[model samples]
Target: MASGMILAGLGLATIGFGARFIIKQMPTMGQKLAEATKTFPKMDSKAFANSKYYKGGFEPKMNKREASLILGVSQTASQQKVRANYKKLMLLNHPDRGGSPYVSAKISEAKDLLDKN
Candidate 1:
């Protein structure tokens, strides 16, 4: 009976610790969500749903980070690299090169938006 009581006490302590940790982390998590919502328009579900890129027949949704990944460039890459990556993707995805124009157009638009920001 004593051992069971000790185990129950330990479990309760662990639960309290976890609750405190979660509470402390909540503000940081909320701040991160707010920043993401403000900074990445692509992350907005409704806006993304209505985007030209989404309407263009892409199989999956692409986020800002995915856009950077697709172009083979850093999120902070300069305008020059952005242009270069766009050209590279154009070559790889150009309709004449047997690539889908829809995908190519999405890539081009992603690059353009990333460059502007």
Candidate 2:
């Protein structure tokens, strides 16, 4: 009974506020969750990417400038373009699709680094 009343109140709120109810912030919450869940490999797991495409050998922790270079974006590229490039690269480096997980992780780390700026 109380749950129904809460839902009813939510419906009223939707009607009053043009459909923005308590669930309206779900996407933001999901985005934050995704950001929180982003992971990069530890140094213990970093060696031997052995990717067909990556000939650079063992890499250290990614820095801002290196991240921009890894994503193939300019130092001044907008976040939108950075994201676009990240997606494009991920498509080519996704593990199940015959790409390297280490490379994928590095790519993701690069994107996160670039997005921060």
Candidate 3:
């Protein structure tokens, strides 16, 4: 019957549309999965803490010039400016926020040296 043929055609069209929709969404789904995997890697916190790069308690000795250079401030920078810069750098380089421990250690050392001056 013509009506039966029309119904079959409609069903085929609906299935085709559904398939196209799924195919169109595949690339976006794949990209989201890739980004999720890349952003959150399997990082063991305990292992990172015990790593050689970790400098939790020990403070390294650094001169005023070295500290100034590390903090990206001039040798004549005021204490307030140094403290502000230190806080900014700490926020950026804190080990808990996906920053490297080694870099954070250097930043802390720079702050300590500047504070002592």
Candidate 4:
């Protein structure tokens, strides 16, 4: 009977030790979870849905330098060359051709800016 009691006491002590170890690790586990969340934030679906391209009224004014870069032309390119490049880029980036509307809009804006300048 005395040996059985000693075995039961040891079993209870082991369980208590295990519980204490898990309780001590709880804060560390929570800290790791918080750090992971900060490193990779959840995506905001509403922000993506509110893009100007999705809204259909986005008219971004392209600058001369940006326009030249977008069209892959030199800033000193002649009007004819700019127009040709613009046509080529539009053919490649048009939304109807499986391109993104945002990219197509930017290309159109670039052409307008280059033509105006």
TM-score leader: 2
Model 4 TM-score relative to the real fold: 0.47
Off by over 4 Å in 2: 1-55
**What is residue 5's positional error in candidate 4, in angstroms?**
64
Write down the lDDT that model 1 would get: 0.82
Ten residues in sequence with the least summed lDDT for candidate 4:
52-61
Q: Compose the digit string of candidate 1's lDDT tens values, residues 83-116.
A: 9989988998999989998889888877976788
The local distance difference test score of each candidate is 0.82, 0.84, 0.85, 0.82
Better of 2 and 4 by lDDT: 2
Go through the candidates in order and give the clash count of each: 0, 0, 0, 0
Clashing pairs in 2: none
Write the number of the candidate with greater TM-score, choosing between 1 and 2: 2
For each candidate, what TM-score against the reference?
0.45, 0.50, 0.47, 0.47
Write the residue-wise lDDT of candidate 4 on 21-88 in tens digits.
Answer: 99999999999999998999568877588675434433355568777887889888888989999899
* Candidate 3 lDDT over residue span 29-116, tens digit each: 9999999999985777765776655254433567787788778898888989899999999999899999999989888888888887
Candidate 1 off by > 4 Å: 1-62
Residue 96 in model 2: lDDT: 90
Error of 1 at 33 (Å): 57
Residues 12-86, model 2: lDDT tens digits: 887978746536978998998888778654555346565456455535877877888788899789999999999
lDDT of 4: 0.82
